[model samples]
Target: MIVGEQKPIAEIKEMVAPYKKLLVLGCGTCVKTCFAGGEDETAVLASAIRLVSRKEGRTIEVEELTVERQCENEFIQEAAEAVGRNDSVLSLACGAGVQAIARRFVTKPVLPGVNTTFIGVLEKQGLFTEECSGCGNCELALFGAVCPVTRCAKKLLNGPCGGSQAGKCEVNPDTDCAWQMIIERLKILGQLDNLRAYVPPKNWNTSTSGGPRKLVREDHII
Candidate 1:
């Protein structure tokens, strides 16, 4: 899932200070899971804004709404009426979601409320760890499901860098050496010979280096 963190209240206050009628839009997908921008978060932020505005002797009207998802047009359409009524929108979604809303409502100012962090997984409650870089090409099968591209500090493809010590990464002692984990996993699966096959240099063209990407399913198209 895409992980993100909410902007501080002071910054958000500044962003919406100019608008009298502001809409705090929440996305109930990735940002929800990370506790950044969900229905509950929207309400909290709206109340906070109201409190601050009141203390400053200013009257600000905040409308709060949460869509199933802010990235998809179908879900975004649900907030059309609310969006049209507001002077400006503070989108508490991922960068993609904020852009999607901005694209749909070309005239409205869509302000981002959260900083998009990375593609990662929930390691435990309240702890999310990045696990993928979305390189476009997946090579997990070659490394026993451990992606050296993301886990390795050096992104080494062949073997562990000589600097690894005590099964920990040389770049950061707190991090486990990705190669070490790969080798141990391969040994347990009795597939150590897979390392013998040489992997060519990664083709970065398939990644973000090639610019924005798109996928079309011909079967699902109208």
Candidate 2:
């Protein structure tokens, strides 16, 4: 999931201070799982902003609401209507969701309430680790389902980059070498031949194309 971290309360307040009526928008998906832009965090931020405004002798009106998803147009449209009634909106969703809300509601100014971190997975309870960089190219088949692009520090295609020592990455001794892990995994599965095949470098231009990328679904065509 796309992971994110909340900005400071002071920063959030500063961004929307000019607008007396501000809506604190929360997303109940990725942000919720990461504990950054969830309902509880939104409420706390709203309440804190209210307190700060009051202490500063400024009457700031802040309201909190969590949408099922901010990335969806339907949800964004509903939130847009709610935001239309307010002066501004502080979106507590990921960068994508924040942009979606902004696109759907071009009239109202949307301020981000969190810093979008990365594509990651929950390592354990209350711990999240970055796993993917969304590099556009996928090579899991060549690497035993392990992503060398993201896991390998050097992002080497056919690597264990000479620096790797004792199954650990040279960049960070604490970290395991992604290629090493892949080789070991392939060996265990008797698929060591998979590593013999060379995978080409990723075409980043197509991946990070300027502006939004679109996909068409013939079955879902309206």
Could you tell me the TM-score of candidate 1?
Answer: 0.94
| Model 2 agreement with the true structure over 18-38: per-residue lDDT tens digits | 998999999999999999999
RMSD of 2: 2.0
Residue-by-residue lDDT tens digits, candidate 1, 22-109: 9999999999999999999999999999999999888899999999999999999999999999999999999999999999999999
Clash pairs detected, candidate 1: none
Residue 76 alpha-carbon offset, candidate 1, angstroms:
0.5
* Weakest ten-residue segment in model 1 by summed lDDT: 152-161
lDDT of each: 0.94, 0.87
- Model 2: lDDT equals 0.87
For every candidate in turn, the CA RMSD to the true structure comes to 1.4, 2.0
Give the top-scoring candidate (lDDT).
1
Give one clash count per candidate, in the order shown: 0, 0
Clashes of 1: 0
